[model samples]
Target: MLSMREFWNIVSISLCVQAQISQQLSDTGHTWNYDDGENDWSKNYPFCGGTHQSPIDIYSNIKYDAALTPIQVVGYDSPGIDHFTLSNDGHSVKVSLPATMYISSLKHKYTAVQLHLHWGDQKRPQGSEHTFNDRRFAAELHILHYNSDKYVDSQTATAKEDGLAVLGILLEVGSFNPTFENIQKYLSQVAYKDQEVQIPAFSIRNLLPVTLNEYYRYNGSLTTPPCYPSVLWTVFRQPVKISQEQLFSLETALFSSNVGDSIPQPMVNNFRQKQERAKRELLASFKEDFTFPIAIAFILGIFVIVAIIIYIIRKRRARQQSESRKRVMYAAAQKAEGTSSIEI
Candidate 1:
């Protein structure tokens, strides 16, 4: 005998295998908009206004932590399932991942929950949440996970500190990528809000960068409403590439409105504006070469300034010498005239 409360938690808010693909979503049927309700998220959800927020601006001065090891996964290559449910959750596109897949190398076993995306539109394409060196990419992909060892499921893990781990893959416009195409090929099928489809499962590891050793690690929160500051963020340095056509499809393929609404809104610019990062340490697995390039540019600038100063000094000295010569010649001519007058 399942109580209605238990059933609802398992079905509506579950991100594990027993649950749906996403948790902390529009599951509450809470109406919020990015364009209008964005500034007012704190009015309804107080956590939106809280400190230690996510999608921070990763500046140049990130500290290199030696303990930040390469992220290891258990069963990402083989999902062990034929198809996974894909849905347009009115905010973003989501795909449910099985609990069989989890990250192994972390201190606790962080099981895979679901993966979703945030993107911009044809007019404004910089939709990525986390910006690196103040550069925002075209789109961003988030693979959500929960601490399986500490909590029963993701729904229970949502509120706890250090309970979530999300892998962020930033996308840029480039050549066609087949791994992303596995999900993108089915975009047209689930274009409207609440539209669900069964997309064939593929290797989740392919979604990540080829080299997992280099990444930026930080402590942040979920980018959406009811923003929980539980996520252990890992944003890869190398961005995933997709062609212009693919990016356009992501921007314009979906609608924010449900299947039947008076006015359908294009689901563009679904990303939240970055929040303030107050006194939190940002770590990197590999040391960034920010100084080498800056050092070269600084030396070149100094040389240019010195060259200009030398040119100005030489020009002034030449002009002064020319004026002195003219004065001396005029004086000599006057003296010669006086001598000639005396001889007369």
Candidate 2:
């Protein structure tokens, strides 16, 4: 019953609002999800289409930054917080961290904010964001931090260059990881979207690899949309292990839909596909070496030499035993001939 002009005006206003969705500071109000594919995110979030994106493929195309020193963290063992807020933010399960834990290895002190995970479903187990030499892991964990020295808060830091630092740890299936269970045991509580729970505080450092010295460093953006190009990424070369059952627990426990939804969607494969590294320089804290290949070659050569030595020793023993048997037979034959001659 409305006039034509009013209908057109409403359409224009809706289009205008959609255009501004990309400019929003928080993703809380947006409808971006792993569903319908990640390519759709770039449409609404302009930064998601930017060049300096994250979750890049890490392979032989990397630089050995000899100048890059080992990673050093402060107050990780004691995060100075009693309880953490674990919430399912519709996309993934996140745990809020304390500002007291800061990383001291970078140019500025980057304080801890929150951490989250990305994983695949039971059907396809591998879902890590970053790939190493084209190899994918079972899952990925991202620990987010903001530049404390230069920025007032995490939100303010998101707009600045080199304002964020993220530690990306690749997770593989193996023995049960108790540190991971501290968070996993509480995943059921935050099973639905926007649901949250309180978890006991533990050593944040334990979540990372025991040796934090070696990693791949680069300047990239946040993997999630409004993919701000402000992160200094450190992806460890070594992967941590979680039991198969534990991995299944993660893939099956959570849902992307809110509680009481008519049709619930499982929160699985909640990872963004890797973005192009584009002309960015990737740095490694450790020196590149042929140690693995060299060690394998050395071990093979030693094995071959031992096999030849054993063959020669066995041949020599067989020859000696055959010569001794021939001598005894010949002595017995000579004795029988002598007895026949004496009888004649």
lDDT of 2 at 274: 83
Task: Please provide, for model 2 over 1-344, each residue's C-alpha lDDT reduced to its tens digit, 9 standing for 90 to 100.
Answer: 87999986774454345334655634446678888988887777877886789888998667888888888999889988899999999989999998888899888999999999999999999999999877889999999999999889997777566689999999999999999998999999999999999999998888889899899999998888778777899999889999999999999999999899999999999888888887899989888788999999999999999999999999999999999999999999999999999999
Q: What lDDT score belongs to each candidate, Candidate 1 first? A: 0.86, 0.88
| Candidate topping lDDT | 2
Query: Clashing residue pairs in candidate 1, if any?
Result: none
TM-scores for every candidate against the unseen true structure: 0.84, 0.79
- Model 1: runs farther than 4 Å from truth? 1-29, 309-313, 324-344
**Clashes per candidate (backbone, < 3 Å):** 0, 0
lDDT of 1: 0.86
- RMSD for all candidates, in order, please: 7.1, 10.3
Best by TM-score: 1
